[model samples]
Target: MKINANEIKVGMLIEYKDDLWEILKTQHVKPGKGGAFCQVEMKSINKNTKLNERFRSNDSIEKASIENIEFNYLYDDEINYYFINQKNFEQVEVKKDIIGEKGKLLKENLNVDLIFHEDKAIGIELPNQVQFKIKSTDVALKGQTVSSSYKPAILENDIKIQVPPFIESGDEILVDTRTIEYIKKV
Candidate 1:
């Protein structure tokens, strides 16, 4: 469907120059001497490429049609990650690069969305927040308050993030997968 350029948002897939692109970031600029425009940063879905473009509010852009399917995480063997279709039970192997750093959060039996374009998996979306056990962290100092500061900690998956001083080893906490930040104790 066609939509105004100003309507575009981060994470929306659109077709540009006959190729599918995923919006990575967008900024609306209103120049003091010129017309307002939206500055967009997009990544190519078919290849490793990036594009930056500017568009006025009056410009219209094509939104790419994509298929989203639920897949259950199975396991990975260092090279490729495996997933099973939740609907048909068919197994699919995806490259490690496509999963990116989010692969570290993948656990057995976790359900995630696999984005497909033209029957090919282009990307995977992990749960917004994941529960992980704190592998290790330093104990809170005597005078530290929860609101005052954050301490670096490692998770069971080996991903390091800042956590409240009160957090310690073996504590299960909710983490925002996209930002890799601590949410709260769980």
Candidate 2:
């Protein structure tokens, strides 16, 4: 899909130079005495490169076609993750890069959205929030109140995350992996 420069927005995926780029920021300027143009900041999907580009107002660009399909997480072998296509029951192995940070929150049998471009897996979108139990953590102090401080805790999968001072071992909490913030006690 070809779109005008003015149509780009943050989080939109675009295809340029045979590579996928995500729009990180965009600004449209119509100077008092100059032609209108758009300034865009984009991050390469695979290479993790960030770049800035300016385009004339009327310029057109190809928008990458991304398909999001729900798949059931089957397993992982320390190198690749296996997912089963819910619609067809066919399993696919997604590389580590595609899983990215979401790999920390993934649990076996969990469902996730497999993002693909031209039938190639590009990203894995985990659930907005996941509940994880703290496998190990120091005892919470009764009167040692801190100002919104977080302590390190280990989860069942051995993923380490910071939790509130009130959290203790054996407690479950919902975490927003995208922001690495503790949402609520579960």
Candidate 3:
């Protein structure tokens, strides 16, 4: 489908120069002397390369058709991660690199969306927030209430994140997967 340049948004997959690109960021610029244009930062899906391009508002771009399939994450064997399709019970193995850093947030039976382009898995999308148990953290100080401060803590996944001072080990809390920030106690 063709879309106006101004309609581009982060996370959208589009075709440019015969290659698929994922939009990472976009900025609409209207300089004092020139016509308005959109500055976009995109990553090549096939080549794994980054690019910056400018498109006028009147320019139309091809938006790639993508399909989202719900899959339940099963397990990983240090080499490949496995997922089972919820609708058909079919299983697929995906490389660790395809899951990226967010793979650490994945727990057994967690549901995620697998993005497909032409029946090939292009990427995986995790939930916005996930619940995790704090592994270890320092106790709140007796008189440290003067200012709001966050303390570093390790999660069950061994990922370090800053949480409110009152949070302690063994507490279950919701964390924003994208930013790795504490959302609230669960």
Instruction: Give the TM-scores of the predictions, in the order they appear.
Output: 0.85, 0.89, 0.90
| Candidate 2 CA-lDDT value | 0.87
lDDT of 3 by residue, 81-142 (tens): 89999889999888887778878999999999998888888889999999999999989888
Q: Please say which candidate is ahead in TM-score: 2 or 3.
A: 3
**Model 1: residue 107 alpha-carbon error in angstroms:** 1.4
TM-score of 2: 0.89
Query: What is residue 135's positional error in candidate 2, in angstroms?
Result: 1.4
Candidate 1 residue pairs in clash (backbone atoms < 3 Å): none
lDDT of 2 by residue, 16-116 (tens): 87789999999999999979999999999888899899999899999998999999998888789899988899888998776777887888788889999
Query: Please, what is the whole-model Cα lDDT of each candidate in the order they appear?
Result: 0.91, 0.87, 0.92
Of the pair 1 and 2, which is ahead by TM-score?
A: 2
User: Which should have the higher lDDT, number 1 or number 3?
Assistant: 3
lDDT of 1 by residue, 1-186 (tens): 899999999999998998999999999988998788999999997786999999997899999888989999999997999999878989999888887878999989989999988788888999998899999998888987668599999999899899998899999999998898999999
